[model samples]
Target: MLTKEAFNALLKTLEEPPENIKFFFATTEPQKVLPTIISRCQRFELKRISNELIIEKLSAISKDLEREIEKDALYQISNFSEGSLRDAQSLLDQIFCYSDGKITLEYVNNALGFIDPDFFFELDNQISKANTSFAFEFVNKVHSLGKDLSYIIEELIEHFKNLLIIKFNSKTSKFLSETILKKYVLSSALYQEEELFYILETLTQATILHKNYFKKIHLETVMLKIIKSKNVLSLDILVKKVN
Candidate 1:
């Protein structure tokens, strides 16, 4: 029977507790409590429980599934949980329900399809479509997938690297699959191999810069600069800023 007025009375109780009495309080959001009350109480902040401890608790709770939950699958789930024991447990419960009491990587990936395959296709189509809106939409969709922008930049650089490699050597071409290699072989003809190599180098440097302190906005600008500069022949002259 804790009403607002009665709740305020707790301060009085706290100021002078009765003999042989004990009290404990808990709250998820402590900011709502008055500052004076908070100052008087001993604060105990709970740290995020480790993955190992979470597995221990889950093992204790479900002795039947202890061995299965203790494996690598739980570690992956804990990573996805972002350091919340309760969230990790909830994820494990959902996974158990869907996986028929077994945990596997395949089940985890299926549950979290955070990326789209069409992301590669849309970027590939950009050369032909030459549409600004499509480029913006595709880049934004990539950002929304919770992927690090640096990874996306690395993927693009690799794509262009494959194309450049295919362009330079016809016999070395067997490394690529028949379908994707064919596309690269065709696309490579548009630029000199030296020029393509320079662009690839620029992209690699940009990817490194992206990892350090550059914001997404600045990274995007640098990526666009590399893409637009594909027409330039001299790699040395283009990277004056880096020098």
Candidate 2:
């Protein structure tokens, strides 16, 4: 039997009058629990650990890993973690595993596996020689890399968001090299800024939908929507158009 069910059974046994018998339930989510069960117990709320404590824990782990933890990386983990020490630790663990413990701003970028500038540039170059088959094949390769379709879409959105930031304020946002994005700037300039904004919004929405449910048809539809809206045509089409 589940522990919860056993606990509930034990509660029944205690319903009458068992002297010196006590039970306690601890949960992050109490609202989902039974109020009747809660009524019988003395409740004690635990204070959440502060951010400074969480950073100290993270710094300790970084020392153990023999890695230099940069401020930007800490900021990324902090932003994504929403003040949960465990979540921040878990994020650091994933990042170190993904990057093999060499932590840097680039390492953070690589851990997330954002779009490669060279690949996008080469993609632009290949437009002339590429065929539609290449685009479908590229999607398959991306799938084989153990990344979910939703994650890939989210990465694309994040990359473009960085680009948009760079476009507006060149000095402040250096997540991407200005040299690499210049090509995209040239290409993106052809379209109205409104269109690019629409594409980003669409990708974000698609990511949300895909994460809610894993549907192959829905994934393909999102990809096709991206291809059409972004003027990518096909893998081949992108190569030729950009070339």
What value does the lDDT take at residue 106 in candidate 1?
49
Q: How do the residues 162-242 of candidate 2 rate in per-residue lDDT, one tens digit apiece?
A: 546655655654333345446656544444444456657777787665556654456556555544554543455557669
Across 1-243, the per-residue lDDT of candidate 1 in tens digits comes to 355576689889998999998788887677777766788889999777765676566666556665364344554566567668788778777777776556554466447543432355445455334444554565577677666776666666766776677766855754333454566666766656665666677777776755567556656665565555545547555575468
Which candidate number would show the highest lDDT if scored against the true structure? 1
Error of 1 at 48 (Å): 40
Best by TM-score: 2
**Which residue segments of model 2 deviate by more than 4 Å?**
1-4, 10-24, 41-57, 60-66, 79-82, 90-101, 105-141, 154-197, 204-224, 227-243
Quote the positional error of residue 157 for candidate 1 in Å: 2.3
Task: Count clashes in each candidate, considering only residues at least 3 apart in sequence or on different chains.
Answer: 0, 6
Give the runs in model 1 whose Cα sits over 4 Å from its true position. 1-135, 235-243
Q: What is the C-alpha RMSD of each candidate to the true structure, in Å?
A: 12.8, 8.8
For candidate 1, what is the lDDT?
Answer: 0.62
Work out candidate 1's RMSD over C-alphas: 12.8
